[model samples]
Target chain A: MTRLVAIDWGTSSLRGALLDADGKVLEERSDARGILKVPQGGFPAVFEALFGDWMGLEGARCLISGMAGSKQGWVEAPYCACPAGRVEVGRSIIDIDVRPGSRIAIVPGLRDEHDGVPDVMRGEEVQIFGAMSIAGLDEGVFVLPGTHNKWATARKGRVAGFRTYMTGEFYALLSQHSILARTLDADAPLDEAAFLDGVTRSENGHGLLHNAFGTRTLALFERMATPELSSYLSGLLIGEELRTQSLQAAGEVVLIGASALTQRYALALRATGTATRTLGAEATWAGLHALSGFLDADRNPP
Target chain B: MTRLVAIDWGTSSLRGALLDADGKVLEERSDARGILKVPQGGFPAVFEALFGDWMGLEGARCLISGMAGSKQGWVEAPYCACPAGRVEVGRSIIDIDVRPGSRIAIVPGLRDEHDGVPDVMRGEEVQIFGAMSIAGLDEGVFVLPGTHNKWATARKGRVAGFRTYMTGEFYALLSQHSILARTLDADAPLDEAAFLDGVTRSENGHGLLHNAFGTRTLALFERMATPELSSYLSGLLIGEELRTQSLQAAGEVVLIGASALTQRYALALRATGTATRTLGAEATWAGLHALSGFLDADRNPP
Candidate 1:
């Protein structure tokens, strides 16, 4: 292939990277046009307007990840069942009929089940693959923190299973819309001390519904200020998410996300005596680049 | 007093009852003007507009409960500490200056602390007292469900301690604002089976954030209908709240609220093999009336 165009098109934003055959990012572009923003039958126009020149490169191929593969996206790329690795996910990469003689594919998401209930992740799968590749490890625990946080276990490069926590979304709701919003400054930056205090509070054996009310009471009692309360709220949620995992057994958790979110996770993880290593946007580019290699084998079987 | 005016002025609504010396509600009136709805310094105007006729009765004395006594309400009634019975709360009631030569008192809310973190409730304390008075039981677990659900334990005619659960508020947020809202009809009436299914699911030990995501998957995979999802979500939240309590040790729980909310609590409690007795608006009136009698002793100290 002359070039690989890797795209991470999620619910709220879209970003793409141009990488050489060696998987090094050469140029990057991003926009607010995520899958949800793209109108029906508008994906092609949007794609061409943003990345058409890059796609015009001789023998160039593009791979898109995230909600862009959902049923509501440009083309519905079905989810790959859990215990998926680079090979399983790669084989499932579906080619969409966007342009003639130019290969364009969407990475399928991954779905895991626990007691007949399903949990899913789309763009995060690529990041997981990228993290594994970057860390040069075959087995480990991976965490992707965002609007929805995912905790997954991988064995020999295959994600065995995972769970999703609505931690970030919940933080947004509680700090912005719930009764707690009355006293919290949701836009305040992270206060490490207040946050750790919240994390400590979560271990008090009273579940989240009960613990969350303390946010209001703490402020009402003047035990915590409004700005710090948001960080404290964040800690409570992140801590609750961490509570569900056997972190001590998992060893060093690999965290993948924006620096701000990963930093918070790292802090929360360390508070539990568990260690973490973080990766950023590079993981998405690397994962897409790695997945692109399987496209040729899928199109032309030996 | 020859007559008593009992009022439950909460966050979104204001209601009052005209009672005889025997504590019987002779007449009632309610308006959309809750404490939050009342304009600045408008409490007297609003109260006079709604209950002026009742207050005009000979020898009538008014007692108000709920958020109307909050710092933002008509007057700030300081909170009474836990292990408080009718006497403690009644003694703590603050008289608000509204009309000359007329008596008006605001019931103080109750505060309970666990390990330095405080949980508080205002109007619900009256309902708990009312339920105890109506059932002739001085000690039991009393649950008042509404925008905020309160679970309290009373012993020897005093509320020993209680916890607050944002269950109802969370149910509203998830069903109306979160991504799950997309597939749920928040206005649909309760579906007992679906609700019970959610309650059982809560016992699976995965916690709420993970269990809540099941709402999306169940709909995505065609396992449950959109309208029924709301009830299921409600069950999950209520179930989470219940999971924190020792229901078997509490004996028969007294549920106090509207028929709709109490009915749901009853259903959930029965699912756990815990017996429940329900009370309605009468509890509020009865609670205020019982406390009104204490005012005479407080004033005369005899």
Candidate 2:
């Protein structure tokens, strides 16, 4: 029987999963009602439309993550500072009333201000927890690849700290708005060789600003085809992301994200002389399950 | 008496200087009729409206440099490849008829393909020539900072090879479009101390992808104010540009560009322990004069 509804409502998309008490997904739904698109005072309506079917189950509760817990979301869950674990995160969850007999809990994001640079992440914290528990790793580096890719350290089943590289966002802006946009083939498949070439090129002593021009110059001289440019650019960006944190110099990294992005990052990491393991979107389920379990134990005092 | 019209028609603006045969300016005009704003088949009209006053003088020939000679400009003066000197460039100018018995010559841009990364420059070649001639340097590195900064090797009065770094363009894009945009003061003056702090941070061995996050982090933490972020970003980009070319390791650099930009680059170069001499926009005048003199000497057989 369904006992919980889990929603990963980010800035641009909404994803929901109906789960049993055992943390197994019974049914899933995804839509475009992300926090940014939700009309004012319409969060409850949208949430009901997406997952109302599962709400009839006895004692069913809603647990939402991602930007839905942000300041702009339905409920503002203040960020929990690191080093935090499932217990801390569960304790920090902000409760909200959705209807007369229904309720929702929004997970708070995490912030790290240790390195003199403020770094924060919302949905990825739970994902990291799931990745760590599933991988059976006591401590390691976790990479969640997306618009703002998160690189976090999991020490003794707790998140110590993490840094964010706006690699994916930078890639999007450059590919769409910069001069290099004209020379790109937007629909081309990934060319592995070109991607690896760009990965290797990232090791060039010149910085990224200098290296970015290579995209244009390569196309101008016909050294690299327009279709291949995108893959190469992806490699360069991911490679830089890896280099920034010295991830390759670290022993191993567990990549948590969609399959496609993780695969690209895995390829880049391996090419850069690092080992990698991957966990899919299921990691979020496992992470949220652990947090919900913590909340249950806390409430019953057993 | 006016014998030559030197025009610097770049991507956004056109600058014209009427000059006597002795290479001294007699009058000048500037307008926003850059190549992008020109309507199809309307280049002659725009040129006339801007520089028509000086055209009535007898034997006044226009020597046009910059984007007016690009493929999208009035006439495509093909790029002359490096190791090209003034003579090679002078020979490559493509002439066009603006009116009956009135002709204009467009200077060819330079391209370097030696480094496997194709690099090209248009207006800077003229500036470099002027900087070199004025400095009386037979061989040195010349840095021309602008939208696309060029670092060219000048050896014995000819361009040997060079590389292009998209430093300024990256700054503009990040300041205006990226997440870092909110952390910048659009109208803030250059903060020298903050700028140097950024230069110091760039040497931390972390790549730019990692370093860029510091902008957001600094502002978020309130360690660095929002208004100071722009200068810091400028320092980071300029520092990376210098680091890529090992410009800091180079003993001295001739900076050729507008005074404001060159001053910033000069500060970065000096902080990095390199000596710098700045040549203002007048270098463009000097460089164009040299090229026109070469053309006249070739035609008169003197």
Candidate 3:
């Protein structure tokens, strides 16, 4: 049985899963030492320290995903252009020789173009695949909410294309650094009512730049409290994001991310009368495991 | 002749003009000590140091505008509900008894409501009035480009209503703090072609949040250079701001702000086939001088 060490290494944190050939997780580990935290040329050392023992298992192979493939990561695993599925992505994996006999590789990110401008994604491609595998979906729309929220479309087992929105980052910037920060509680939990209000407000023909200012004015007029303002701001941004999307009435959006963020997206999608199914970190593990199949094919070409 | 000291004290800097009764700027002084930098309870001292001599002139009255009237400013001058012009604003001035036999007052900001959501502006109201005064027109569309860009309307010498866009602040935050900052030169001079590309990109119906991420991909693909990315981002934001405005074909926009910002706005406006006239710091001085007439009428009512 070929054991697998699957890793999701992002900008700020890292997680690893050790799985048996059946794609069943045997053990999981995580760390705050993401790509950014890794010292200059220290990726190999960090990777060895965190998952070295797991890799020692007989026939164990490792596949790293996310920012680990970014130029700033362990090694620059160049992006795989879109209309890519497991096979296309697997074929593009770049190997990094950590040791003379180690079998380790990084999954390439994906890029799609729109009107001559390109949009790129790092790790969410894995989650999309995982979500598809676990949900029995071959074609669907998926939303991954994070610092950079991505809306992706999959068709016939391949990621057709996707677009990125700075919704989450804008929320952070406005709620912590902009003037609205003065009147908002940055850490406050989601206030569904206030958030919905913001979402509804976003549909009012006024753009986000104008609607965002309302966050400050709402506080100044004592219309909304400080705790709810953050959620309201989040809603406004998420709502603006939704405003740009053309979701079909019968289509369901598969949301992949931490529950804290996906739940918000689920709520926002629900508000738009669209249904959603959410997948968490397990999707990342499942995705990396599924992609590991390509490694075996690469070793023994058809 | 009643000597006048007209001051525009905002968040980051302070400028004062010693004006004659005819609203002629005799001597002007400026400092980096905006309302935010003024030490707590130091407004009196700062005022005395910078323009106290001008205020000391016989019968000189000071009219302070901008954030100096906010809750955090020298004193909270409650906002005057809109449909406000020189008379309404002057009548609502909040006095701060600076010294015995001294006249020092802060002009109240303006608030307008749209569908229950409120939009407010402090310093820009003065600029709109000044723009109107200098342009020899009572009713027109006025845009003040700054930290919080205001799009205001005037009718019969009164500011009918306005909306605010956080374009400048968003540009600062995104260029200085957001992920796009990594690939951009935040202080690059405006690249007209790149900027126009952004403006044109925004018209594609993809919202700002989504279009903004293109900044990164454009750089990643080597399609756009680093310095041009900031200007492109600026164009995207200003373009989004313009998208929300409903400008009439025959109407002209009066832009008031520092030349650098207004020039960019003028460029964006021109892209939409709109004619614009740009004004500078002189607008603020002229605005306060024009409003001084209201102060006299307040003391001696009809």
Candidate 4:
């Protein structure tokens, strides 16, 4: 029997997994039904349509994370202040009114306001907690690579602080919309050498705004081919992120994300003389599972 | 008589000026007809439509600069190597065939192959040459700010060496396409304080990939208003460009570009402790006219 339903509802995609009481995932499903593309029936209706069987089941709870918790999401789950963990996130879950007599809990995102500038993350917080749980560590730096890459520090089983970098988003914009697009091959395979070369360039301390011109000049001079330009750009961006962020202080960096991007980050980090460990999407599942434990405790106090 | 038609044909716009035999401006005109927008009739047809009367005038020659010399322009006016001045640029102009027995010369761009990567500029070279002519500087650094900001060094009245920074292009992409776009007010008036704040941030030695995130967080936390974000971003990018390109050695920097942008660069350079002198787009006219002199000389030997 399905004990719980965990969903990662992001900006552009929705992923759901049904888990047993022991937290073993029984079935998984995903769709392009992101919050940005909700159907005529609103988020509740769309959630029902996508996970009908799992819903309305007796004693089975549904947990949601990611942008679904934002102001633009199904229900605004106000962010919990940072230096938080599973209990902090769990206690902050807000209920969503839905049909079929279901108990739906939306995981609140984490916010770090100490930096003078407010930085917040919804889905990545779950990944952070999950990576911490999986790595069996109480303190570490977790690098979650995505459209907006996140760098979170975990201390004593709680997120200490984190910052967001628009690395992937800027890469997409540069590769697709800027003049540098003229010299890139979007469809080409990853060129590791060029990507590493970009990482090497980043290490030189030449600011990114200046080094980026090399993307064109290198191609123009035949020093780097068009196909390699994409990877080189990727390396440069990720490398700069590593160079500037305070991720080096952590003993071992934990990279949690999809393998393709995580691998690239790992390569960049390793090249910079830092060791990294990779965790897949299951880390999110594990994080959601751990947070669900808090929900169960709230529903039934000992 | 309309002695010469000097055109600055760039990627997105075309500007033309009519001059007499003594290089005095007779009339000026500009249009959105950049090389990127030529219709099915081709460049000659577009040129004729834009400047019809001046084209067929007796002894009215045409001189074109900028991307009109690029591979995608009307005809590729190959780049003249650096350590070159008016004479080199003039001799390198390639002829374009048009109606009315007209003689048209497209100015060659400059290429600096001294650095491992090849750096090239087309119309800006004309402006640099023009700035030299106007300021009477035999040697100095001339910064031409635009889509691709060029930092050119002149020694003995010739372009010594230069570097290209994608500052403007990167700013455009970040403000219009990246996630930070949501926090910016593109139509807002310039904010000098916020812009200087960005310059101050650049001085902290944090790489741009890290600094750019401030645009988002500051706005999110209400520390920076939307309108101010644009100028702050501008300062951040321009500051990075100035920091990385090594323009400090020159005694006095000559900034040649549009007034508004040059003013901003002037502020940025000043904040960085460097003095600047501004030159308007008339410099391009002067450079093209000086280059046009070469064509007249070829017609009637000295």
Can you write out model 2's per-residue Cα lDDT over B223-264, one digit (the tens) per residue?
A: 898779999988888877777675544578998888879999
Residue pairs of candidate 3 with colliding backbone atoms? none
Which stretch of 10 consecutive residues in model 3 chain A shows the poorest summed lDDT?
A: A293-302
Which segments of candidate 2 are over 4 A away from where they belong?
A: A100-103, A297-302, B297-302
Candidate 4 chain B weakest ten by summed lDDT: B293-302
Question: What ranges in model 4 sit over 4 Å off?
Answer: A39-41, A99-101, A221-223, A297-302, B55-58, B97-102, B296-302
- Preferred candidate (TM-score higher): 2 or 3: 3
Report the number of the highest-TM-score candidate: 1
For model 3, the local distance difference test gives: 0.89
Model 2, residue A114: C-alpha shift (Å): 4.9
How is the predicted docking of candidate 1 categorized under the CAPRI scheme? high
After best superposition, candidate 4 residue A258: deviation in angstroms? Answer: 0.8
C-alpha lDDT of all candidate models, in order: 0.89, 0.82, 0.89, 0.83
Q: For candidate 4, lDDT tens digit of each residue in B168-285?
A: 8888898888778888976678899989988878766556766788888788668988889999999888888877766557778999999878999999888777899999878988
Considering TM-score, which of the candidate structures 1 and 2 is the better prediction for this target?
A: 1
DockQ each: 0.82, 0.68, 0.89, 0.62
lDDT of 1 by residue, A1-302 (tens): 57998999999999999999889999999999988899999999999999999999987899999999999898888899989999889988899878998889999999998888888999999999998988898889999999888998999998889999888889888988899989999989999999998899887768899899999999999988888999998888888888778876788999999998999999999988999999999999989977888769444311
- TM-scores of all models? 0.98, 0.94, 0.97, 0.93
